[model samples]
Target chain A: MASDQKVLELNDLNVHYFTPRGAVIAVNHVNLYVKKGEIVGLVGESGCGKTTVAMSTLQMVSAPGRIVGGEIKIEGQNIVNLPEKELRKLRWSKLALIPQGAMNSLNPVTKIKEQMADGITAHEKISGAALRDKVLKLLNDVGLPERVYNMFPHELSGGMKQRVCIAMAVALNPAVIIADEPTSALDVIVQRVVAQTLLDVKNRLGVSMIMIGHDMGLLAQMVDRVAVMYAGNLVEVGPVGSIFEHPYHPYTQLLIDAIPSTKQKKPLKVTEGLTHDLRNPPPGCCFQFRCPFVRDACRQKPPEFKQMEPDHFVACVQYN
Target chain B: MGGLTRGYFIQRLLMFFLTIWIGVSLTFAIPRLSGSDPTTAMLLTMMNARGYVENADKIIAAYKESFGLNDPIGIQYIRYLWNVIHFDYGFSFAKFPAAAWSLVTPALPWTLGLLTVASVLSFIFGVTVGSLMGWRKTPRWLNNILPVSLTFTSIPYFMFGILLISIVAFKLHWLPATGGYSRDVNPGWNAPFIKDVLAHAIMPLISIVITSMGGWALGMRGLMIGVNNEDYFLLAQAKGLSPARVFFRYGIRNAILPALTAFALGIGSLIGGSILVEYIFAYPGTGYTLYRAIQEQDYTVIQTITNLIIIITATGVLILDLLYPLIDPRITYKKSVAS
Candidate 1:
């Protein structure tokens, strides 16, 4: 249902970083779609290309990391071929990013209201009372007191700052919001509050979001669909409940097993060995060495993603 | 609140007085400790006749009375401190009857004008160049230029000054070699006077700029590099900020904080350099007057000039320290106390 209403369609997206060592494949032929008014969670362990995928969506990847291949279409328009100026026009208006470590994201010297005003003024022509009112409304919408507008970022607590970041992200009411580990730095309580605030904003504003995180449980609460990534490739993707209940890919299974559960009396299932290094990734199944169910065929050739159920895709020799 | 602030103000004032006292005591004792008697020097210079029967005690007594050197150390210190507080530095021994303060006052503006203009120009140029080089990583041209620029910055300003004087003034004769202005023109606020002063300042200004711009560029470049790596800058880019805005608004603001502190400290030391540069150019500035006072061992003039420098430097540092809290809220008195 969510896949059918696609708002952002990434086709064969590949991102490579030019390091002194060589060209490292950070995101390899990854394809996914984010639908309108639905949250899509991109889950992966550290250095698994999830963040790279999100960064490439907005063309925010810095030097050395270039989106070498693929097409990114937003609202059916191919953004990959668009000029930087046109791409910039799409950002914050068509697609906004809530970057990692939202706590320190704000300008320390400027007041919160001024920071919001900067965001507003960047894309719009409103000023004076209208701008002030818009900033005040934004502050209020993020569950922050109106008085917070006058305070500097240093004056606010970490949680308040994160809310300010969210406010800034959603200020222009962009169609798609990419939040990369927005609540990772906060405590559990603050994390919940921030997550809920994100959800609340999405629900009220009807903005599609791409939530990136390593934690399945956190993403489980916010996202409608989950795309699991491993070794710079998307191994599995499905509806949130389907992926969580019956994960097919060995990597997805291990990721779910690794999650701590209070109800389960048995010891937590931990995946052995580290993730494959992208610099010299194995030719075959990237996770074969770490997979418990690896077969001879798994070492011979990488398995392509096959749909076992409608909109539920998994790439594994065992599943095939 | 007022009382607390006033108390803090008073504490700073007390510290200022203590610093001056220590400086004066060191100056006075150093001459005595060196086993050099001013009285003996004066007597030797005064005596013209060969093998004249000189009563040393009488000569010392007369010298002590004439110069108020007969007073007890404590009494003299108190009198000196009083004179310093009142800004009444006595006459110069080198030019008797001419007040030291009067000589210093006229020279202060010339030195300050040259130093201020040169320092500001160099700093601005350096920061601009450094920031641009640091932000744009792709251009191989910047990578090639940065090291050469840093090498230029590492050379001492005095060496640069001498080099400029040799090349531009003496060898090339493109500029006047020495003296603030031509002998014919009297120093005034008119166009001709200003032009002459500026013409004379050209070599020194270039020397100062070449010597100082490198450090500013190096400092700004390193800072900009660090700031560019920060998450907030990345966030600014992610928000679709223009490269220029990100470079200036986010990158420059944070990067330039360290440069700002350095600049503040530099403003204070500008006075110190003014003396040296002025002396080298034979510019009629406070530095030249101070040099004359030192040669004549004019105690009052020396004390007054030294005190003015200390006061100016101290005040400049205080202002810079105060500005830290405003620029970066993380800086505070509590942090200083804790450290």
Candidate 2:
């Protein structure tokens, strides 16, 4: 992608969490990029560091979990070294986040209007009529009505709460929005609606997005690109169609294979062996223990990411 | 929305008055139900202490008529309730026949000035420190504050009061050991009088603050830790709200709600005065007056003080309940179950 076209780029990004026992690498050296208005999906199972990537995108990681090393660039400006004061100016305007579990994402003690006003007024001097107008417009855009403005979180249904959260995320018309499992907490029917709303908002606002979720099927339908992660390492990243059709990494292949088919019933394809303990991660390919074609080289040393095909990168000795 | 708010207010007001009524009735009934006449109890206590009983029946009959102890129980209850509404409590039988209200009003200011001010000061200080300690990124050294607060809280209130009195008053003689003010200076609004009052109040205030501040700190710390784990807090941080804004607005704002109940109860107790602390220091507060009334079998004073405590506590809760909607958006009187 051209420099100007790239809205977000993560290069050599490393995040580690320090515990009493030792430091655990939550996000290893990972590189990913998103073009303007493109939707990218970070897919991995629980604890695979996809959430860390989303948090690190905005430098929102909590205590004991530090970036340790990385550069997070937004619109050609590196944000990794930006002071907190400057970062505050950039956030919710240039970049925003739609956190997971929208049910609890909103402060229960606050009304929807106050919640929206908090974000808008933080960056601008809008209040009262102007603020209400801005919040109402955003809420309307998310299919919520003016009545919800005065209502508290508990007064709204789960779907309505999720919409409010989305409205808040896009309230400032950010350039890039990182949505962490935006539809995961909703039921299947509600999830479909919420997922559709997210896509509609992205298209309408023309904002680039990095969506963090564990469902490959949902991601395949919504995202332009999918980056598959395993045990804190990016195993494969490519166009969504290519990832689903011809995944290069063995782990990605198994991940796609695990998705159940509706037309025909087949025994579920289960990956072999247990995941490696993050406290003492294996030196070689983290998936070597589960890979069917594990090699001596794979056990001895980790494989470097290589381009297997046009715009398709994978970390496997076979691809190398 | 306005209608809902008004509804909520009316509902809370009804509950508030009902609570006070029940508390007052119980207070009145508890003494009468003990089945000992106040006059007889007074005479018996006096005689037992002096080892003599001369003209006891005459004194008892006079006391019965003077104190209205001969009235029917139901009539007496009504009379007592009426007197309470007007803040009148007749005369005390426990100490030299002084007006019951006179005994309470004189001590009210001392207890309120001492304990209320100290508790409020401690609450403000405790919450600020506790919230800082609970925030995830605060330095490790801040965590040390928790154990120190816990140790302070573990020392019983009376024990700490005695310790402070012994060390600061007896050993060092740095401060006055007893009374609400220096008797040498007649009570007044002058600077010297105010200074002396504060000097006498310092020991008890220190004891109340040191022991109780920990509970507030510990409670607030636990609350902040829970709120910190909430997704809303993370969302607030992600919004790039300034560290101070996130810490105070999102973290402490929600955490402080649960602490309000404790604060209200503390205010009520402060108004009522801590009995042991007051007795130890002989602070001339309501607590000390109540102690004296108990010893002298002063039924009128006893019932009135008990009713005063109940009224104050119920009123505190009522005020807090009314103020809930202003502080928290989640609370409303509307039937929220339909959602």
Q: Which candidate is the best by lDDT?
A: 2
Give the best candidate by TM-score.
2
Native contacts, share recovered per candidate: 0.44, 0.74
Angstrom error at residue B121, model 1: 1.1
Q: Write the per-residue lDDT of candidate 2 for residues B1-339, one digit (tens) a residue.
A: 322377798899899889989998898888777887777777877888899989999999987887677899888889888988998888887666688888889988888778788888789878877787778867678776555665777898889989998999999999999888887887888989988988998889888888877778878888999999999999887787778888888888899998987888766676556889998898888988888888877877887888888888888898888887778866667775636
Would you estimate the TM-scores of all the predictions?
0.90, 0.92
lDDT of 2 by residue, A1-320 (tens): 21239889999999999989999899989999999889999998898999989988898787688898989999889999688889889999989999898789998877778888898888888887888888998889988878999888888888899999899999888889999999888898989888888988988988899999988889999999899999889999998898888988888888888787898876655447878877788888988888888999898888988987778899998767
* Residue range B60-118, candidate 1, lDDT tens digits: 88867876777887887777777777777677654557887887788788778888899
| Model 2 misplacement above 4 A | A1-4, A125-129, A295-297, B1-4, B35-37, B54-72, B137-175, B336-339
lDDT of each: 0.80, 0.85
